[model samples]
Target: IAQRAMEPWAGLMRSFRAHRDHVWCKLSGMVTEAGWRHWKSQDLQPYVDAVLSIFGPSRCLFGSDWPVCLVAADYQSVKRALDDCLSGLTEEERSQILGASAIEAYRLPL
Candidate 1:
């Protein structure tokens, strides 16, 4: 159902959904979204996979919400959780998600 709904708008939705050259931020808030107490890296994998599928590694960036993420886990825990979710990716792909994508997406100077 959700997939169907997104198909039609997929192209235009690139602004946030990640299509073509558009990028996406795979950031904090997963723990709360997955239920804080029971949240695990596995619980976030499906979502992470979906974003990676939609955006591809070259168009995805990692972001941290800092104090907001503190509601569920410390900064290190959040980083670990995202790292675990992305553990299966190739080193280059991981590099893209970790920083390269942001640099390209925002056209930031080196």
Candidate 2:
């Protein structure tokens, strides 16, 4: 399994959380690690939980991974997977992952 497999990074995520003010995590480019043809939203939940648990919604942003992700999943599927993974969170947290975090991270001119 590659580094993207998510299990090994739980500890790293914890370590990284110490720098949460200076670090950000983009929830993208991971679906293929669950396997291109067989991946399901359930397979994605643990990874999402890890990040949200470690970084919280304010430190995360959704990423489509675009043409690269096309190797395993499409744009809508990627979004839906994140939505499923985020189901237990409050609406504001979900919104943070979907858009606001990116805006804050990049200091977007919105």
Candidate 3:
């Protein structure tokens, strides 16, 4: 399971290096560890950096787990937390994080 899971990360690194354009990447969701139910806090920044470092600010997106996030935080709180985490990024990047990335990825109408 570990090996299978890592393949996509490897592939993304390779692709990011190869393509100069932006790529939308999704991190693995909340994990199970030490009987504590929480998202991987430390891993978040580095992963965000990896994506931003490779694809720049325009390509990144934030996801609130919605009903899943509700397991620990309400939807509004989740949204606020995402906003706080992404506060350092540009407005354009923030826009991408909020919804633009999804529309672009799925080829939805703007």
Candidate 4:
């Protein structure tokens, strides 16, 4: 089974969906994972859409990788890129992805 039963991402999505009770996903670090020099937000849209579809807004959160991301993009660029990817969602969904989900995931006092 380990030889060819699963593609890495396919396996990951399956596992993620199966473990929804405790697992949540963070959409971040994309800039570092991409081309870095000339990558565009559009380049990340598909992956973002995939994560959102599988996890839904409630179980997905946004993260800014901060100083580590500076190697590939500035802080503002990273944020703007995620905002662009999230542009098509409803306001409530965007709010969930942007902030609400994090609060819930972390059980923050806010």
Cα-based TM-score, every candidate:
0.77, 0.90, 0.58, 0.87
- Residue-wise lDDT of candidate 3 within 5-110, one digit each (tens)? 4347746686766775545664323222111245434424454556666665556566666566555556665566456556688888888867787788778985
Give candidate 4 regions above 4 Å deviation.
1-7
Clashing pairs in 3: none
Runs with alpha carbons beyond 4 Å of true place in candidate 2: 1-6
Q: Say which candidate scores most in lDDT.
A: 2
Sort the candidates on TM-score, descending order.
2, 4, 1, 3
- Clashing residue pairs in candidate 2 (N, C-alpha, C atoms within 3 angstroms): none
Model 2, 21-61: lDDT tens digits are 68899999877676887788888888888888888888899
On lDDT, the stronger of 3 and 4 is 4
> What lDDT tens digits, residue by residue, belong to model 1 across residues 22-93?
436555577665666667888778777766776789867887768787777888888899999999999999
Which ten residues in a row are the worst by lDDT in model 4? 1-10
Candidate 3 ranges beyond 4 A from true positions? 1-23, 27-46
lDDT of 2: 0.85
For model 2, where is the 10-residue window of minimal lDDT? 1-10
Clashing pairs in 4: none
Candidate with best TM-score: 2
